[model samples]
Target: MSVKIRLQRHGKKQKPFYWIVAADARSKRDGKYLEKLGTYNPNTNPATIDLNLDQAVQWLHNGAQPTDTAKAILSYKGALLKHHLDGGVRKGALTQEQADAKLAKWLEEKAGKVDTKKEGLSKAQEVAKAKALKAEKEANDKRAAAAVEAAKVEEEVAVEETPEVAAEETPEVVAEVAVEETPEVALEETVAEVAPEETPAAEETSEETEA
Candidate 1:
């Protein structure tokens, strides 16, 4: 049976993760796999790929036909480079030791590049977090300042209103009290004049009755 290298669909709906595998060409897409090569998760920043370089290269040497996506994955993980080195070994163009050295060097370089990318992402995330925090603090300060200003304005309005309310009420109360005192004072003056005239009449009547 002819063999094929392909990806098996897994994970959940709308979020797909995949497994790279070598399987029989006649098998269903997810039914049976000859060997599980590795896993692929595209939900990450760098789109994670954990592939077995040696196994994938072995599968390639055994004439396993890889699907396009699987081939790309193999190429990205240096499996294709290993396959090329194995071919060079077969043709006596290079020794096995040289091939291994070259592969090791390449993997080291790739690892360094991946590390650099991760560091860059980490720094970017830190900067974004700091910026968000600063913005939030600034917004809170503005709100607090606005609250203080509003309180001050309300206090000033209350101060302005208190005097006006007192001024408006005081005059009406004083005028009503003054109007009541004016009537009492007029009646007291009239009673004093009548008392003087009655005293004089009483004295004259007493003198006349005695005589």
Candidate 2:
């Protein structure tokens, strides 16, 4: 029976967690497994992985084929490297002490790289947050300036309209004064013409009475 080292899917939709296991290749993906190796959680920053290193190495030595993703996990957790070093030792390519020293050195370098990547990610997040806040503040300031400009325009319009209204009222007042003066002037002219005719008629009547 062909045994495969692979991941079994679990957790809810959009949020996934998995179990790394060795199972028969013909078995259902989430069905019975031969051995539970570890767990993998992709939700975290660095993608959390927990593994039983000795069990994983034993399984690999037993010819359990790992899927591509599972292989990457094994490599990341140093299982694949450890197995390679052991093979090198068995083949007389290197001493066990030398292999262990090499692995230790590689792990130290890998840890340093991981730490640098995490620091870069954190700095990038802070910059993005600051940029977002600055953009929001700038937008608010622009809106406030636009509001002030609109209010100033409204005030200027009101100021200009008040003078026009005052000008219109002045013309109406002048027209009213002219209308009142015209009627009084016409009455004075009529009284003066009638008084002259009355004086002429009285003088003619007195002469006829005396004759």
| Local error of candidate 1 at residue 32 (angstroms) | 1.9
Instruction: Give the clashing residue pairs of candidate 1, or none.
Output: none
Count backbone clashes in candidate 1. 0
- Residue 28's lDDT in candidate 2: 97
TM-score of each: 0.79, 0.78
What's the CA RMSD for each of the models?
5.0, 4.1
Off by over 4 Å in 1: 172-211
Off by over 4 Å in 2: 173-211
lDDT of 2 by residue, 1-211 (tens): 8999999999999999999999999999999999999999999888889999889999999999999999999999889999999999999999999999998998888789889989999999999999999999999999999999999999999999999999999999999999999999999999998999899899999999999
State, as a TM-score between 0 and 1, how close model 1 is to the true structure.
0.79
